[model samples]
Target: MNLFADMRAVVISALDQMVADGALPEGLDFANVAVEPPRDAAHGDMATNAAMVLAKPAKLKPRDIADALASKLMDDARVALADVAGPGFLNLRLETGVWAGVVQAALEQGSGFGRSDMGAGRKVNVEYVSANPTGPLHVGHTRGAVFGDALASLLDYAGYDVTREYYINDGGAQVDVLARSVYLRYLEAHGQEVAFEDGTYPGDYLVAVGEALKDKVGDAYVDTGEQVWLEEVRDFSTDAMMDLIRADLAALGVEMDVFYSEKSLYGTGQIEAAIADLKGKDLIYRGTLEPPKGKVPEDWEPREQMLFRSTAHGDDVDRPIQKSDGAWTYFAPDIAYHYDKISRGFDELIDVFGADHGGYVKRMKAAVSALSDGRVPVDIKLTQLVRLFKDCAPFKMSKRAGTFVTLRDVVDLVGSDVTRFVMLTRKQDAPLDFDFTKVLEQSKDNPVFYVQYAHARVCSVLRKAQAEGWDMSDAALAQVDVSGNTHEAELKLAAKLAEWPRLVEIAARTNEPHRIAFYLYELAGELHALWNRGNELPELRFMQDTAEASAPKIALARATAIVISAGLGILGVAPAEEMR
Candidate 1:
């Protein structure tokens, strides 16, 4: 059903015919030959670089190869013309029936229209939103959550077996700090006034956790020192915080298939085993790291420590796995976690991290490479900061002011669909501006609203057609004769619809879910444009005065809706039937 792929096959067959006829040399590699939408739509329906790529390899002139390829290509019923231009680019104008066939295919496939089997069912583990289990997720984690969830869905649509995962950072020193913070809250619950100092969390979110602890064990650690309550309180508080985080993610429509605990890597022999696997390959050693360039820490002193030879695999230098005090460094657990992922037999691994973790990307990749012996590839995507604005001014959140925006706050303001869609409107590696005023605006400038409006518009068309006694069921729509619809605007929409399956494959291959958001915007733009064109041109209108004509035209409009719904489904956004 992919028109471009179909046309590419025709182009390849023609090239093979040329080789047989002695119009071109034998055994020219066609891997670089690509058939894609022409840069200018006015040029043609599709364009191929076959002549240009094979000219030098075949020792033939560009125009000569293009002429021979064009003649052979024109023999296909689908191809109307294959014109050579600019040294060997072959621009093709496909028959109107080809575009109509695309619309018919969309209507026939329904939600499965754009599903691709490019991944061949490879297992992929996507770990994201692994924020420190110290507090409720904030705005920073929101972007990662949305991006990761959408990516998992996108890969699934592209036929990858995806596992959405969250790695809890409970084994770090930050959890101990959370423990002390909850102890203060516990004292407050016992009617004792306590001030939150420099090292403890002061957010009111933990107030309930403190009260719950008191309820569970009344007066047990009333005035005890850190020794008696630290360990127990740490475990209790981390569980509470993780609950809060899980609720926050649920509010944003994110559900993880697994919640991996960092603490689990500590008591088990997992860390030792992971490092031992690397050591067997001579990748682990006691080494001194060079001081970071440009701005060294004031306490800069070289120390020999247990390190991973990350430089052997693409990192800038070997990274420390253990501190001088014979304790595991932060990198140790992460390495062990990835090793665990590799052991789980995933064919590939993807990690979505915040932009601040950019420095850790290389080392993590190195660890996975060493663990899997380069058998599996790890792709780390960094989601940059999201700047919020209100009243056309920058909105700042301050932890000290007790006004920091949580993920719940954003979802509550705009709902999960808007929040998720808006978060993905920008590339993960690029900074995004989430303007409260702009996102909710009903105009076409708002992508979420615009895409939703296209779906809703299609619903309006169906309702109108049904009220007029025109059969508009899925089965009836699939039987419509789209052959009568040949308007340039209508064909343009069908052409855009043809790109959906290709878009899914590209987005999944690049491990980018933002591309789906971008593609949806473009598709919505085409749909809206065609709808607007109908206002000016009577022939382009969907609802005809007669049932026979209306069924065919409205069928195309319904086909647009089908593709939009499929695309939105991949983004995990519910397609709107009507927009308020």
Candidate 2:
């Protein structure tokens, strides 16, 4: 159960009583009224702005409303103290029984302690790592992959019907270049020396694709023209590249429920159908174009083109769906792709694009809005660049990816766990620096290691307890009475655990999964701090002179581990039972 939500309900009940007694006006909106942790712990356990928010609206004074509300709340046994602060902010200190119940709740709930029903089973499509199927996914794609996968997992934890998806960019001219690159490698595999031109992919990863192509075709397309082999080789090369991409993603703990093909939209009339749908809404138009702002193109000229009226939905300018040459622009396929998602009955769509795609966000949102007639909401999250560091210097590029560090290289160096956790330590829109120097360190400086260490410490406590012939299972710990264990050290940790359910809803609502990583780190810190306190205070320890007496203390430790495991599960990271 959410302690904050429960307290908010108590505050709302008090306000309703005031309205009933004619002390406050009726029909005041409580939607903006919030009950949350007090800014200063010294103030109280929780605070609410119910009085201040309703004072002006109710035509009443702040102090008068706050006093009446506080008096009404004092009748509840759960509320130990309720007093008005500076204005009408109600600062409340809950009874110690309330905090103890949180530990009991965590033990009873196990890893599902913080799972929320905030999403209410809404279907959400999360598309990420939609790199061109020409080669391996690189470091930039790795960040997007981790962010998107973790976000999908987070939303699922918050009760969303989430789908992890990847879009393959095989419908564009880039795939033709990949075909030519594989042809050159195919020629090399046949003992004919071939040089990679400036536009060709020369990464060693393609060598195997070329050899496999030669094995299947066996000189059938060796001396053929472009028309005869372009389609076939492009298909072959894209399949192989996707196979490699899947392996790379698998190594990093990423698995997509859907691998959508851009090519599937090309010949299936899906692109035309989506455009036609928009055309029916009067969103499509043929209009003269203006040159872009600042530096204009050298060949800038006014041309009538098919455009989507994106400006109506908040885009800076109308986006062209078709070019002067009559070929569909890159934006056309994305519109069709999102339209297809809407047709599949997804309530929400989230695109996890690299930071370079920031400029496309408004247009994409506009397309989804027009396609769904504003019935659906689309959120585009941009993952910023990850600058890698090793040996106190910037990391070098990968030979496998030719121009960047491949995802496999990072996973191979530190394993998938470190790579994933470090990738999410920062906000998705903020740049992150992944330093081998810092991440691998076994100290509080390394967030992943620090959090894992806290979990491992709890496991060690349980093992010690079990070895002493004391049962430490969740059921046994959950049965213990936590009211007697009242050290500030223990209660502080319990307070942090109480924030979990509230934090989950906040993160899910904001579509930010990094908040989970950050929260886990703070929770781990509180746990570690409590552990440190035990060294100075003998009674504060998990194990005491008597096994039965120490059960309540052990319950607290186990509850902390339960929440840690639940949080790590959401981030797609494994909780370490023991540190290596």
Query: What is the C-alpha lDDT profile of model 1 across 237-350, one tens digit per residue?
Result: 999999989999989889999999999999789999988998999998998888999999999999999989999999998999999999999899888999999989999999
Determine the backbone clash count of candidate 1: 0
Candidate 2 global CA lDDT score: 0.91
Off by over 4 Å in 2: none
Candidate models: Cα lDDT each: 0.89, 0.91
RMSD values for the candidates in order, in angstroms, are 1.5, 1.1
Which digits, one per residue and each the tens of the lDDT, describe model 2 over residues 101-205? 999999998878889888999999999999999999999999999999999999999999999999999999999999999999898899999998969988888
TM-score of 2: 0.98
Error of 2 at 570 (Å): 0.4
Candidate 2, residue 503: CA error in Å? 0.3
Q: In model 1, which residue pairs have backbone atoms overlapping below 3 Å? A: none
lDDT of 1 at 244: 89
Candidate 2, residue 414: lDDT: 92
